[model samples]
Target: MKFLDQAKVYIRSGDGGAGSVSFRREKFIEMGGPDGGDGGRGGDVWAEAVDGLNTLIDYRYQQHFKAATGGHGMGRLRAGANASDIVLKVPAGTQIFEEDNETLVADLAKVGDRFRIARGGNGGFGNAHFKSSTNRAPRHANPGQPGEERWIWLRLKLIADAGLLGLPNAGKSTLLAAVSAAKPKIADYPFTTLHPQLGVVQVGNHSFVLADIPGLIAGAHEGHGLGTRFLGHVERCAVLLHLIDVTAEDPVAAYRVIRKELKAYSPELAAKPEVIAFNKTDLLSTEAIEDKLKDFKRRVRKTPLLVSGATTMGVPAAMKKLLEVIDASRRGDRPADAPGITTEEWRP
Candidate 1:
């Protein structure tokens, strides 16, 4: 299935059935009274979050959804059957918005979450309902109310424990592939990964979901490159893993560029706990790695880890640090101290 994070759809509820108009007649009775029954209610339109779905691609094919109309009333005081409701199944983390796309209508963040999108029109009244002592032969009835209709937008934001952030070709994808089962497209060129990718990384007895999004470049918030459109996928992450290519002309500058973009996109994202790492250390010698790590710590004002995504070097340390932050975040006791990296080698 293709990944579709956003989609626009039109929906309408079913109309109510009309009420019946009838009068009872008996051979032995001199006069008979009206006995029309009420019409059935119209069907409703609802949206529900369900399991086994991760994309909104299904909505791309079908944009219009409507509920069944209520059955009309019949003579002899018989009421029509109510129409069945229409339910829309969507993946977890799907957010529903108005046509403008900014007005949030609902956020289906977890499975079994549901919301009503539209209501069916009520059934019309029958002539028998107008009968009274003064007006025994009433002949007027009310029309059924109309159903509601509207156009809405659906946007999906992936849920993950940690998110990877870096510049293009910073080895973000390599790290994800090395530590998890996710097979992201890898290339020496830029923008090799177009969409967001997810993987589950298990370290020791603990496991957490990791998300990797397209790399960010300078001025990404101003529509530069892929822009910050994919950042939404990582908004819910507890911590951010920022990787910088040690071979880059200036690793500190690369780090700063990504930070600037994050702040420009969202303050909350920028404030998330970040673990800095120097990737592609396999290409550098031990001495060179030590020098760069010191420089990074001095300039970035935080301790940085050295890891080689291709060789799976120092990956366990990275994963461990990420899990630490994730656990702290979940308990609402986010560590106030700066993030630190462990140099000791540990196998996953």
Candidate 2:
């Protein structure tokens, strides 16, 4: 299915039923009182978070949702039937916003979360309700109330334990496919993976979801080259795995460009725990790899893990490093000064 994260839809609640105006006209009944019946209540609009869904593509085809109107009241003191409610089943991590898109109405981070978007109008009273000793024969009946209508926005954010971030052709997809069962497109060209892909990574007996999104470049925060729109999917991740191509002539520049974009998009995202690794060591010689590692360490003062996603060299160590931070975060013991994994000589 085509991936869609955002959608705009119009929803309306059902209107209340009208009351009946009838008088008791039975045989041998002298001056019978009014026998009008009350109207039934209208239906409500609700949104629920369910399982087995990851995209908002279902809302693209249908944008409007309306509840059923209540039935009208009948004679002989019969009340109208209440209308059924309309429930929108959305995926977990879906957020509901107002028409302006800034005011958050609801944020469903987990399954079974529900929110009432629109409320049905109350039912009208019958003429018999107004009948009194002085005014026994009431001639007027109350009218139904109108339903509420409004447009809203739905935004979906993927829930993952770790996110992969890098420049285009930086082996992000290769790393994901090497570690998990996700079959993302992999090629030598840039932007081969157009959309975000999710995978399940397991270490020992523990497992966590990992997300891989389109690569970033310079000016990405300003809507250039897939923009920072997909960055929202990784905002909730416990850690980010930044994979930089070790064969790049200027690996430091490539890393800096992506880091700048992350900071520009969101400071919190930039501040998240990140595990940086030099990927694709299979394409580099031992001497060249040593020189690049030395250059990176001298410039950034941090040791970067060396890995080859194609050959799966040093991949296990990288997974273990990510799991450490993920475990700390899940245990509510996240630390700001989490250390990066130490780099070792990796050969295909």
Candidate 3:
């Protein structure tokens, strides 16, 4: 189950069957007319979106897909049988592109979505069709048409309600595991989580999907440390959760670095509604945490939530705040939650 978000494959449709050329030669019918049968249409190639799949790794092993060819026509006015179609199942949110990778052919965002990649060739006409009053003994038969073929690219983007953004080892994975059911790899070292993980967070009767993306570095936009390869997964998210490690030497500097990388990768991502959280507060003393919070507020003029993912302290409060932000965002509120609203929004 290696995670693969992109793939390239070649698809070909089946060719039509050839028409039959025969004449009626019965014992009592000496002056019989042509009795050739028409050919059948070729099979088509299609791509469909199905559930229980999250990657395009299946396409890595097999790159070519071809449909069955139509059966040839027989004598005695017998028509050829149509070929079966080839259906390719892919994960939801998969995007189909042409060989150039710029021309979008289809976007499968919902389950049961389907796209016809290649169309089958039409059947050929038989000699009986050309027989007329002036041309009674016609013996001409047309050949089958060629099928269509093309190379396409498939790209998958994870769909979620919220996405977590931060630098390496910023407790993004810890926060995700603390609030949701997802158990992403967590360690003290940087880049412990190399891929994006999804989780569902339920608050009372409401639930929303959250995605924990791989940590980013300073030159992430320029292919540094996993770079912006996973950035596309966050493009569909409705909100962003910016988690900054309060125990870092300079929390403000860490926050700015992630912001710079996000803006460089996609300005639209940086413009998304974000909820800033200061994580790993359990590692700091009460006085030190207060000082860090004061500095964070004075420098950014925004009050961020304080939480400890390891000890689960303030975790419930954090989840409540996130739910409120998600609710406001769904309501299409401009600038969903204002700065310095953390104190008033969090009841616990």
Candidate 4:
């Protein structure tokens, strides 16, 4: 199925039914009293989070949702039937917003979450309700109330344990395909992966979900080169794995560009635990790799792992390092200065 993360919908609740105005006329009875019955209540509009769905593509074709109107009342003290409610089933991690798109209405982060978006109108009173000692034999009834109507926005954010970050053709997709069962499109051109992709990575006996989003470039936070549209998928990650191509013309410049975009998008995102790695080492010889690693370490001032996604070299060490940081984060024991892992020290 095609992926869709955002949608705009229009919804309306049902209107109440009208009350009846009638009097009983029985045989051999000299006096008859008002016997008009009351109207039933209208249906409501609700939203619920369910399982087995990860996209909002279902909302692309249909955008309007309306509840059924209540039945009208009848004579001889016969009340009207109530209308059934309408429930919209959305995927987990879906957020609802008002028409302005800034004011949040609800956040369904987990399954089985529910919220009432619109309430049904109340029923009207019958003529018998107004009948009293002074006002006997009443012949009037009340009208039903109107329902509410409004437009809303729905946004989805995927949940994962770790997110892959890098520039276009930086070997992120290659790394994901090598490590997990996800078949992300891999090509030499930029932006081969248009949407976010998730994979289940098994490290040792433990497993976790890994997310791969579209590559980022300069000015990505301000709507350049796919913009920050897919960045929201990583907001729930425990750790981030930043991959930089070893064969790039300026690896240091590439690192700085990604870092700047992360900080520009969100400060909290920038503060998340990150693990940097130099990928595509298969293209370089042993001596060339050593020389490049020395210069990169000196310029960046941070130790980075060396790996080749195409040949799966030094990949196990990198996965183990990522799992370690994820475990530390989950246990709430991540240190302020977590040490970086190198392939030489932690070979798998």
Q: Candidate 3, residues 1-348: lDDT per residue as tens digits?
A: 799999999999888888888898899878888888888888888888889999999999999999877777777888889899898899888888999998978878767888778888777778888998899988888777879999999999887888988888989899889888898999999999898999998878998888999999899999999999998898877788889999899888888898899999889889988888889998899999889888988998888888888988887787777778788777975453321111111010
Candidate 4 regions exceeding 4 Å error are 332-348
lDDT of each: 0.88, 0.89, 0.85, 0.87
Order of the predicted models by lDDT, top scorer first = 2, 1, 4, 3
TM-score of each: 0.92, 0.91, 0.89, 0.89
How many clashes show up in model 3?
0
True-structure lDDT of candidate 2: 0.89
lDDT of 1: 0.88
Score candidate 3 by TM-score against the native.
0.89
The alpha-carbon RMSD values of the candidates against the true structure, listed in the order shown, are 8.5, 9.1, 8.8, 8.9
- Stretches off by above 4 angstroms in model 3 are 328-348
Worst 10 residues of 4 by lDDT: 339-348
lDDT of 3 at 4: 95
| lDDT for residue 326 in candidate 3, whole number 0-100 | 80
